[model samples]
Target: MVLRNIMIGIIIIVLVGGIICWTLFSKELREGKNLPLTGVDFKRLADGTYTGTYEGGRFKWRANEVQVTVSSGKVARIALLKSTEGRPSEFTNELYDKVIRSQSLQVDTISGATITSKAYLKAVEDALLKAQK
Candidate 1:
């Protein structure tokens, strides 16, 4: 009877630990999930130069800056400009090509790095809006 209780207790402990881990991981995964970049209308942009920043105002992913330029109603070029202390910004950097190629923010976010993708799109949208003004 004592052995049965011990086994049950161990099982319960393992199950609890698994649940905790899954909860934490899921939250992180969701945050990294591609968030639909809403609230910015991209059609109102006009040809001009603008500057914007993203992931800078948030304490979450820690990427420093993403600067972009648009011309003739298309993404002319993008610059990494700056990044966080030690985090690799390459994956996020590559997203610019995808965004430009698609000519919209509907492209897929980078796997394993969704927050940065959202940040990049946000930054681009911001710059475009400023250019319009």
Candidate 2:
């Protein structure tokens, strides 16, 4: 009888934990999808290297940091310094190239990885904001 009760208790705990994890994951995804990104002006940025970070300010699933190098009043290079994915994923790599190429945050996100692309972009934007004069 005691063993049965223990098993039931374990099951209940597992179910509750699963529910909490799912809820948090869903919330983070929703927040990422609706995240607002203000466009920064490249011409106004100073020539220097800047670092930026974004941790969603709440759920940290998308936490990341990036280094942006500006030269001659333009973004010359960008390096993913840190990320939850251990490094830049294919989507993030592609997105970073797009950001550097266009020099804008208005670039299109990866079709299926919009949240991830935005997460990395947010980090890059955080860094670029510091570059603004």
Candidate 3:
């Protein structure tokens, strides 16, 4: 009986430790400390239609889509087809302007919604690549 109680205590301790570690790691990742951006080649894209996707990783809901259209080697329009609520939706509109005006996905990530910004940028990049192909 004593052994069983010790084992239970150990398990509880381990579980709690794991939860704490995950929480800390997730926060670090969301803050862009643990997560590193692997920049994609956006210049390969030509004038055409593209499909993009963005997943917020652990920060927000996974799965998002963007439709991109390029004209004269520049972004003509960017449409956020789908995204999670909160920051994602708010940033989507802002992204459209930034991308179109800048003609690139290298714009700054949305303030306060960093993860969502990353996801949106990824999705838009994917769409632009699709259009190129």
Candidate 4:
């Protein structure tokens, strides 16, 4: 009987934890989706490197800063300098490739890593916005 009660308590704890996590993550995802993913107008930006940071997502899934290099009025490179995870992941590479290829933040977010992708994009946007001249 004691074992059964312990099992029941464990299940309840798991369920409650799941519910709380879901509520928090769902809210974060909604806010991330609402954030503007507008494309940067590289044409108007000067040729220089710019750094920007954004922390607009859930605590564990946010991009901290992005380093954007613009050259000759084009996006030359993009790098995620910092993130909540403390390092770049495969999603960051994919997102960077898309932005470099398209020269815009209008690229699609990485599947299964939407929040991180958006945070990276937001950081890129912020960096490029500063380069506008």
- Which lDDT value does model 3 have at 3? 100
Compose the digit string of candidate 4's lDDT tens values, residues 35-129.
Answer: 78667665578988999988757674765788999887778888887777554478888888887787655444545545677788898899799
Whose lDDT is greatest here? 2
> Compared with the true structure, what per-residue lDDT tens digits does model 2 show for residues 5-71?
9999999999999999999888878888988878887658899999999984465667889999999
* lDDT for model 2: 0.80
**Which stretches of candidate 1 lie above 4 Å from their native place?**
1-25, 56-59, 85-93, 104-133
TM-score of each prediction: 0.44, 0.57, 0.50, 0.53
Return whichever of 2 and 3 wins on lDDT. 2
Tens digits of lDDT, candidate 1, 20-107: 9898777756765744465654555577766665563233564556667878776777777776645565776677778777666544
Error of 4 at 27 (Å): 1.2
Q: Model 1 residue 48 lDDT?
A: 70
Q: Model 3 off-target regions past 4 Å? A: 1-11, 14-17, 20-44, 58-62, 85-90, 104-133
| Number of backbone-clashing residue pairs for each candidate, in the order shown | 0, 0, 6, 0
Residue 77 displacement (Å), model 2: 0.5
Q: What TM-score would you give candidate 4 relative to the actual structure?
A: 0.53
Whole-model lDDT, model 4: 0.79
The digit string of per-residue lDDT tens for model 3 on 60-86 reads 554578898877777788887776745
Consecutive 10-residue window with the lowest summed lDDT within model 1:
54-63
